[model samples]
Target: MLTFSFLLVIFLLTILLAVFDMMILDFSIWEALINLYFPEVATGRSFVYTGVFFGFVICIVGDFRLYKKKKLKKNHAERDGSP
Candidate 1:
């Protein structure tokens, strides 16, 4: 329940950030992530773009959260296995 709410907030914020990036910066985070892995996708002034930055921020936050959850679960399982 708590994790679900946290994830929901994160997803909503990401959506808002993406919309802001598109409206203000004029680009899609999805497009930028593709361009990040494949530079040939979206070129020219790419370094100054917002999509890649937003994608990076969103991915990092999400990864950090999932890592925390995974670690917690693994520790729980280890303790359960111990005794």
Candidate 2:
């Protein structure tokens, strides 16, 4: 359930960011990501993609870490016979 919600939120936010990029920078999500690697080939948009990509990576990594920690704590509690 938590994973589902996280994915849903991420999907919606990614779409929102992509739309904003298109409206303000005139580029799709794919183009923005590509531009990060090949600036000379995919020039036009600003450096917003760098932040967006980094934010995405951070969010995903943080979420996974939190989920894993929670799961481990739950297992530990169960092993210790705690409620």
TM-score of 2: 0.46
Candidate closest to the true structure, highest lDDT: 2
Q: Report the C-alpha lDDT of model 1 over 29-75, residue by residue, as the tens digit.
A: 88644443456555665675566567666767777898899999999
Scored by Cα lDDT, where does model 1 land? Answer: 0.68
TM-score of 1: 0.40
Model 2's C-alpha root-mean-square deviation from the true structure amounts to 6.6
Over 4 Å off in model 1, which ranges? 1-48
lDDT, candidate 1, at 16: 73
**lDDT for every model?**
0.68, 0.71
Q: State how far residue 14 of model 2 sits from its true place (Å).
A: 10
The root-mean-square deviation over C-alpha atoms between each candidate and the true structure, in angstroms, is: 9.1, 6.6
